[model samples]
Target: MGDEWRAGGFGLYIHWPFCEAKCPYCDFNSHVRDAIDEPRWRAAL
Candidate 1:
C-alpha cells in the first residue's frame, strides 16, 4: 500500500472543457472554449 504512493507519487487532475462560472473552493487548471466538437474531442482523447 505504501509503495503505491511512493512509486506513483501524489497528484490531482481535472478536465473541464467549459467553465462558465468560477468556483471558490477549487484552485486548479481549467479552460473555457467558445466552441467544442464533441466527437472530435472524444476521439482525440
Candidate 2:
C-alpha cells in the first residue's frame, strides 16, 4: 500500500443569477433585470 487515502471531498456551488435590485459594484457573473422563477430554478439544481 502507498499513501493512505482520506475521506471523499465534495463541493456545492449556488448562483444567485440576479442583482438588478442592488448596487453595481459586484464583479461576479450576475445578471440584471432578469426574472427568476423559484420552481424553475429548483429544477435546475
Candidate 3:
C-alpha cells in the first residue's frame, strides 16, 4: 500500500451531477435533478 501510494494509486471520481439549472452548452456526463432521493443515493455507495 505504501509503494502504491508513492506511485500512481487508485482514485474515487464522484460526479455530483446536481445543479440548480443546466448550462446552454453542457456536454458532460451530468444531470439537473429537481429532487434527489438522499436515502437511495447513500444506498448506492
Candidate 4:
C-alpha cells in the first residue's frame, strides 16, 4: 500500500476521548468540570 500510494498523500487518524467542556449541539461524548487533577489522571493513563 505504501509503495502504491503517493509519497505526500497519506491519512492519519487519532481518537480523543476526553473533553473538559460540553457543547449543546455536539453528539460526541464530552463532560464539563470545574477542576482537573493532572497527576492522578496521568498516572491512570
Best by TM-score: 3
Of the two candidates 2 and 3, the one with more favorable lDDT, higher being better, is 3
By TM-score rank, best first, the candidates go 3, 2, 4, 1
Q: Give the distance in Å from residue 2's predicted Cα in candidate 1 to where it truly belongs.
A: 13
Is 1 or 2 the stronger prediction by TM-score? 2
Q: Per-residue lDDT tens digits of candidate 4, residues 1-45? A: 665457767776553445676767888665666666757877775
Score residue 7 of candidate 1 by CA lDDT: 73
Report the C-alpha lDDT of model 2 over 4-40, residue by residue, as the tens digit. Answer: 3333354457877776665567667776766668698
Question: What Cα-based lDDT does every candidate model obtain?
Answer: 0.66, 0.66, 0.76, 0.64
lDDT per residue as tens, model 3, 14-38:
7667677888888776778889886
Which candidate do you rate higher for lDDT, 1 or 4?
1
- TM-score of every model versus the real structure: 0.37, 0.46, 0.48, 0.38
Descending-lDDT candidate ranking: 3, 2, 1, 4
How big is the RMSD of model 3? 3.5
Worst 10 residues of 1 by lDDT: 12-21
Q: Name the candidate, 3 or 4, with the larger lDDT value.
A: 3
Candidate 4's TM-score reads: 0.38
Candidate 3 has its poorest 10 consecutive residues by lDDT at 1-10
Candidate 1: C-alpha lDDT: 0.66
